[model samples]
Target: MKLISSCWIVDPSTFEDHVALLSSARALKFEQHCPLEVIILSGFNELQLDYVEELKALNVNLNDCTDITRELFLEYRHLMQDINDYEFLCFIRWIVISRFLVNEDYVHIDADLHMQINSSDFLKLFKGLTGTFGSPCLVAEHGGDWFQAYCHYFTMLINDKSGLLQLLGDTEISLIRTNIVSDQDLINSLEKNNRLPTLLSSFNLENWSVFINPLWPYITKPSSPVGFSQNGPIDLIGGKPVLFWHLQNDFVSFLGRYYLLVDLLGSLGDEDLVVKIPKLPIPYLQMDCSLANIIFRTLDGLYRHSRSGSSRDRHKTYDPLSRLSVTQRFIHSHKGREVFSERLWWENSVFLPLNDLT
Candidate 1:
């Protein structure tokens, strides 16, 4: 199976975090009985170059990491055109999957993650599934209160390239290609078009507890055991042995929640294991009470405010045709639209109707 990830230089800490991420993936590969291939799409940064060299020096594979040079970016200029760096990175990830779809299927992982266990079961489950994609779990907004921002983790198992191509029309593809909309918005559009994959019988995707998000408050309490169990060799999370953990956002934002876990994992006696606390390049001061709350809220507001009005509307609208801008309306109209009618049929089969049936 092929595993892909993308990275751009955000900061020194991010690079360090990626190094640790690769280290963990290397460790997990040693435990795996199945064949696995890892590839990385990387941006051009001197530090990134140095980091790649360092990883190579440590015997980590650097052969598959593709550098996004200006010439290469120009070749895939359609994907890079009109998008910010974030969108550019996202589009590259899609390209990685699209170009390699002949290999049957692959998993796309975010850079800020570490594997804690052999993921053979998880990989087999994804390979056996009949769907356009398999996500860890679907999470509604605010933990199921709203559908406006419904999303699954970007770390996904994708299959059925034809279905994906049909669902993302040329215009929609352009938007995605150009990074006009986020991947979450792309999933929302899928839901709108009734193109989302359904789970196979008795094979609930949510039942697979392979990965854990310790950053979420429900799993890691400030006062509880940090991520270890006295009775077991593996770390316990949500009453199960954790296989992987995602450490997203800035180091400061995740300071309290992830520090303990990072410390525990970093302390493992294995010479092959090398988990490190990601250091932020910028100076930051710790704060408490009202000051922290205000800063966080203000940051949230600014983030929301930065998003396009159309994107905001897209998230809030359930009907595909409602409140759509002229461009959006045109994009939603495609030459050969694919759709599925029966939930059971869609769930059990991979060859969904290539024409819109809804």
Candidate 2:
């Protein structure tokens, strides 16, 4: 069968088993349905520890990789290796090169995302796009700058991959020194070379169409099909996303934004009680469950219900089948509420478009 346009890249750290478990779950789910290839460029630590064998059983092909290129502070000997790793996804243009095998357009989902999407549904979306999955396109969204978008966009599609190559410019070799000592050095070099996203505005919406699709990797909310958004969640030809970003560390900065949204949604309370996301699962990448609570009552609002002051009657929603009875009822009550997307990254693969979100 011809390959589909979907692939994933994940850096699995050993300490972050939850993240690994999530990534493995994703690889398992996607490999079965999407007919797409998934690539994992993670460290050897996970492999040396035997967790990778479990991961391998999930149909993942592990490429030995490092979080930081060089270990010691001495001279940067692995700078080239480091640069190669940094520019890892730059190869979206060539679909034939993947070991996962494919002849169509694709998306690279981060391991952190916890989507409830059926991989088959996404495959259908690509079938409509009519390009090889790995093909590139330019997409516009409400985020920092093109570079950041470019990273995710690289997995999505627009027009011609070659066109994208020309527009984004070729990857610079000197730019990637394998012997690089620190992540900072690699980041600084790229930022200086203008290879990274421009900091002028994280909100700078572009029209040029970098890599298409995967607009927001973790977020399920939709961007209009026509062009740049003048509004929010305005569904177009495809459908509005039920998903949202589930970022971990950034929570400290995002709390007030959600509060503002809550107040706005509550003010409009009628049928739409402002949705409340449940407490987000701790990001295993940054924190272990030992220190990280399985559930945080903070503003992350992942599994949390969105409560609108306007709606006198509580709305129905869904929680994992794992919850207790009272918790189950509580989970069912928060429908139509918006959840923060940044917190529940890993769940995207297994729990996309929760039956409730649908």
Candidate 3:
């Protein structure tokens, strides 16, 4: 099976995560036997020469998208000046995929993911599945009200790029508040048009349990692998092998509080294991039974409507306060804006190619 795997590398700080991704790919049995090309679509700050050199050493291809990304952003600069660098980078993912991938199947993995099994098997599995596009993790029902369908785009396999490009359309550079409008909405739009394809099967194990007990190694426990609901968390899957851990968010400044568990994964050796839940996070536990959470959610709904005004009714925003961590909440606060401003100043001065700006 001819395959090309691609991922975006925008931040220098995520160099370790990128390294882990490469290392896991090398560990794949199929990678050793078959011809697989790894392409890193680099974004800003011109990744440290050492990191680029290391990836090249592993036979990984680097396509420095710094200038191209800037040029593309320029096309939308009239309406995009206020958005952050990451938002600009988000728009470049599908563009890079479409441009580089020739006549072959491709898998798009996020930089933060850690592979447990051979990724080639993942590609082979999905390629044979019923659908033009496939995602290993299909979060069926998610959140209350809006955003009920959580289609995880972090790990996606597509037979070709045309289906995805046709769905995304030209509204590529837009933003929802301070963040890029997520791929979930794009997938939802595809579903609305009846273009969304069947999702590939994989263990939907999240490390939410790791947050409750840092020392507990849930990977070794017995949990039912099948019978996962589309909505709600996958707290129990007895003894099922996990395909990959979606170490989901940005790891630049804040690794989730449970990130220590990811570090502990090395201790269990390389084996397909489903870690049992010691205890779920306090906030997640409260959502079902706590009066406080209910009241807080009620207040949060009011706050959303109050702040969103008419736009609240126009497009339902999916952000829920109950899901935010201390660091996430901080980044969403007024102080976060000041911090981001300083960071943006630094980025604009150092990383951004100002000469290219019009």
Candidate 4:
């Protein structure tokens, strides 16, 4: 069995620190558990063998796939012109897995993330889900579903080898007009038709009753006694390494970015904890790409979220302890009625260790 990191880069995107950052993530992945390999699922182009070798020589692994041939490149170019990032992500993600027969439990990390904990430990985050585990329960991140995530964070545990093969097999060769979200996410209609595939179950993931804040270490059980007595879960608070550090769209998209999950490598000590949100891409594009716009956008969002009293709320987070002598699991052993709150969790600055997994 092998753990593989598969990624594709558009032809024109500059290689600022993207390669270096992902390489660090790969290194962390190896440090946590079994030694892993990086599978570069790139467009098979002619020539540039020497350049490819140069990258290999520096210890960055490579594998070639012709998924991005002349035929597909044109479609990608058209998407870029129309500014369809969502659809592009979907097409690229499914394609790589399809080309590679990833039978073993492999974790997929988006290229932009920098690892704080051993990347391999991330495998534990989504270990058992068979990908086809029915409807996954989702946390209403922005309080409600006003602006929710179409997909979960980048580091996903994909158990099924045929994850989304049926839906994506027949991609059309036409321009994606009107809305990019509709063309890419494909969820609005899937939900309407009642034909969405057997996606991962959401209830299982949210089974932890008490969040043993590694940072706080205290088990913050259900807010109310009735909830605890009624129904929840029973899980232990064992010591585990923080999973991964994600940097989304400049500002720390995940609340965990605010605090560092110090316990990344189990008992190895808190050596790789990174607190504080990553400022911005050092430089978005080398050749006059709009770096200023990206930075401004993040700042603008943070400011808006703060002013509206909706940006500052965040989910409960934890810090990793340096060592652990016992294993812990949570048990939400109660059945309670769902209640609607007048105010929603509007903040995003969660107190997560820089190392904790997203």
- What tens-digit string does per-residue lDDT give for candidate 3 at 191-254? 5454444332232334222111111124333242122111221122222333444433322222
- For model 4, what is the alpha-carbon lDDT of residue 173? 16
Q: Over all chains combined, what TM-score does candidate 4 have?
A: 0.39
TM-score of each: 0.46, 0.33, 0.45, 0.39
Clashes of each: 0, 73, 12, 43
Please provide, for model 1 over 25-80, each residue's C-alpha lDDT reduced to its tens digit, 9 standing for 90 to 100: 34444232443343455533335566666555434334343543333566654543
* Candidate 2 to native Cα RMSD, angstroms: 14.9
TM-score winner, 3 or 4: 3
Which residue runs of candidate 4 sit more than 4 Å off their true CA positions?
A: 11-13, 18-23, 31-60, 67-86, 102-105, 114-116, 132-184, 187-242, 252-358
Error of 2 at 220 (Å): 14
Ranking by TM-score: 1, 3, 4, 2
Off by over 4 Å in 2: 1-37, 42-50, 56-105, 128-358
Error of 4 at 271 (Å): 25
Give the number of colliding residue pairs in candidate 2: 73
lDDT of 4: 0.32
